[model samples]
Target: MMAPRNIAPIGYSGGSAPRSGPSGTLGADNRLTTYANTTRRRVDTILELFFADKARRADSDRLPPDIVGALHAHIFAGGSRTRATLCALGWQSNGGQERLPGAVLRAAASLELHHAGVVAYNDLIENQEPRRGIVPLRRMMEFRYVSESLGKQSAGLLGLLTLAWSDELFHGARLTARQRCAAIPVLAEMRADVIYGQLLALTGMDCDLGDVDLALRIVRYKTVGYRYEHPLQLGASLAGANPDIRRTLSAYARPLGEASQLCADLRSVFGNPLTREQPRPEDLQRSRTTVLFNIAAAVADADQRAELLTLTANPDLDATGAQRCREIIETTGAAAETVRMVAQRRALALQALEATPIPMPAAEMLRVLARRVTANIPSSCCLGRGTS
Candidate 1:
């Protein structure tokens, strides 16, 4: 467990909205707006280009008509394109040139595609409907009467293919075969980690009290690896970053990724306003593991814990029952504890940045993005130290 020294959060005081990007149709809102402002023109442009490319690729007769249609719909639906956008931004931050290679754009697109595919899988496993504010792909493609197995399997394989596409983008005669080979292992590991974590979550393994550390470990392996380190490393590697810089960036990325996931988990527990999606307390109804359930399980006494467990374990828990469970988590201070955990991870992320020799602008941009990510979570703001 490596720890870094104190680094205060960079506060954003001005209550001003970000300037609109060149594409005026898309406006900024809250955290996303800042991200849009920071990477606006370039990120937005490349993302549109990527979706266009994926749509084209899916349109080709390479796959069945239904599968391709499903894939296309999944890609174009209202995703934030955060992963791809972040990769592009990371490349720029690392002194990579403004005009990214086609391969780089594809690599970034690979992340978004992979994410979309998994979201579909998540919906199937959790038996939930809704992604990026729209209906889940499972529901979109499923036979209403029959179970959504075929649709889920299709999306799962598509997700697998999208993840594999990341490696294909990096492989070529242009780069040394040895370099390409070296990159494959790291990328594979990252993809595998996410799959395993997702599977654990799907199985409700996150409910076991002793498994919280294991759950965190699962997230660290699955999420922190790809969303932060691997993408940065890939960019750094493409630009020929030194081992020291790679390691330093990894250090900085880990906590940031963890913190980001924590915020997402918080959103999963406490509805997202921008997306206008409420947290599904009955996510476990579809086998989704949640931070709220984990904390409640850990701190609540036996009878109380059993009641919480009943709310989670019971498939019968409807919207009203789910809301009650949500109430219990909040009443028991589990929500407060989760807030503390997110703050701790966020602080750790900032400290890791301090330990490294990153430039001010790049660092500030990321800091702003991090705060915006967590701002939606009221618990995140009240970190128990009165930072709110």
Candidate 2:
């Protein structure tokens, strides 16, 4: 495999405290506080709108009876809402009105639905046993009233259909026909690219390492571009962001997305400050090709590094094995290195925001808010609930 790229981490240098808000009181940073509060409110509204009874009214007619049960179960079940949060914040930053058009709201909620669908499929493939603190997908379907195969099939198909619905929702926007048409291809491309990233991570193919260029390409393609930039772009698209503003968001999203994903990488491997429920951080067990993983594996001594590799490569390793691997990684100091990297990425994200024309105070507030999310792993935020 080619060596991995070395982009900076996405978080601050401070310890795993998830509540690292700005030093000043909420009084001083009220604009940021307001923005965050508004963002959270909007995120909630978006979810309610998307999953509301009205949202489900069309389902029975739209989906076959066999799959509707599974589809309804996953959609109504609470989920990360990360993409919706991203879109809401991005829309606000782009000057979207207090009551964003229904189209934009639909788009934002659909982004989350697609994300959930992806997770459901991923769990099935990876044989993961838990999601949002619930029993595994297999158990959810089969253990209660049906067979495991029926449950698996239901979970898998529901996820797939939800993904398709996410696309249709985007296409159904109220924007000008021309604008909507233009946005569809861009959104579709971003959605497809995320799946590609998942495939690359799952298959463990040999990737090129010598080219620093490839690393950015991988990160941009697999991580940054899809995670933040695209969602921001979609929000920008909704608000009709000018070319310049769009370009600026593109630049800003890279570091922010990297930091966010890096934090996830940390939780997956070292420990999640946001939600500590993972039996094991999925990244290490899966040997995800995160930038931090590349650095840690490369930097460790031969014996330790080999041990890390061996542990991850074992497909049969269960939760017990995941715990053992976490021990190996911690002993090798890889966990600390991962923390350091998150700090670096956080800095990069802030720097990108600084260079943009966004008002300095507002930009600072956004940075602080980003920090808040990063800091709140396993503690304030359970994978299933609000931030700690």
Candidate 3:
């Protein structure tokens, strides 16, 4: 595939151009940043309007005020906003105008609500104590419940309600019949992929640690389909993209999404202070089988494999144990291998992008995003990096 054309390097400072590099892709970063910021602002506005509508009805609704408040808080809590951003990018890349139509913005923002519902449900399943840097929604609702059972049920109900609200917001968009028809199937596929991925993960939770294929299958369905492919296709569908364009976008999205998830996995275990705050390595503590862990186990010597098995056997690994597990992973070169996989997938994604006939701006934006997502993995998480 030929290299991307018409790219300009971004200048970090104001009013002065940096010396052009061999690629001359400097100003593209500035453009991508502005585009991302605009998408975020539009999505935020949609969310505000949604919350306003809810507030107007809250006074008369039978639900308690605190429940509504908690829901609002959960929505407002910070996140990467990746799905909505991708939706807007996909739409714009597929021939949507610079000034996004209200319907498009509404459709894109609805993905955020759908994500909120998924996270809320995920928290319940994982029995997580915190979500989006705050107390889990269930715990927030616990005080309002008459009993623990009632609280749990209410939390689940809240998640379902969010999903309903997502559908409501989506339909509220003034999409044409064709757009609706195109978009609905993509949305359905996204939801089903996530549900299936979750089921697979849950079922495989206690399976053998050596099952790398199963682990990666979970990543493909859970991360690639839900987070990347579906959202991109939804945006493209909204823009009335043809089947061929949608198919081409998926060709780019699949590897990009997997690379994105692998970067996330590395960051979660190593550390990424850039995108979001790092959390405790939940995969280790929960003994969840991930591609990284499986890779390490597969390559480990007999004693190292035994060590991994011992560490993962604990449901609540302490900080020291988590550190030891990280050491084992690094020592075994799994960390480096994971980083290498990210680079390989990223290269494949770029190659796919080069082969596609998408608009230059969209293709460039995606290339920039691919670099951004995978940028710091090797530097921050490599074996000799001293574990942050």
Query: Largest TM-score belongs to which candidate?
Result: 3
What lDDT tens digits, residue by residue, belong to model 1 across residues 1-388? 1111121121221233344543422222333444443433443454455445655676473754455555556665553456655665566556676455666655555566566656666666666766445667777656532556766665557666655544444452255565465555666776787788776665545446524575577678657776677766665665555666567677767877776676666666566544456656565443235555566666667887778777777767788877777666666676677677777877776676676665454555556565555555644323322211
Off by over 4 Å in 2: 1-66, 136-138, 144-150, 205-223, 273-283, 315-324, 331-333, 359-365, 376-388
lDDT tens digits, residue span 1-388, model 3: 1112222222111122323554536566566667766676677777877777787788787666667678887776655467887887789767788667889889988998999898887777777776334677777777676566777778889999999999999999999999999999999999999888878877887787768789899889876897888888999998988777787789888988888878777766776544344447565654356788788777788999998788767777777888888888888888888888888898988887766578888888788777766665635456532211
For candidate 2, write residues 112-139 as lDDT tens digits. Answer: 6677677677677666775544455556
Could you tell me which 10 consecutive residues in candidate 1 have the lowest summed lDDT? Answer: 1-10
Residue 297 accuracy (lDDT) in model 2: 59
Ranking by lDDT: 3, 2, 1
Q: Model-by-model lDDT, in order?
A: 0.58, 0.59, 0.76
Residue pairs whose backbone atoms clash in candidate 3: 8-25, 8-26, 8-27, 9-25, 9-26, 9-27, 10-26, 10-27
Give the Cα-based TM-score of candidate 3 against the true structure: 0.87
Model 1 has an lDDT value of 0.58
TM-score (C-alpha, index-matched) for candidate 1 = 0.77
Best by lDDT: 3
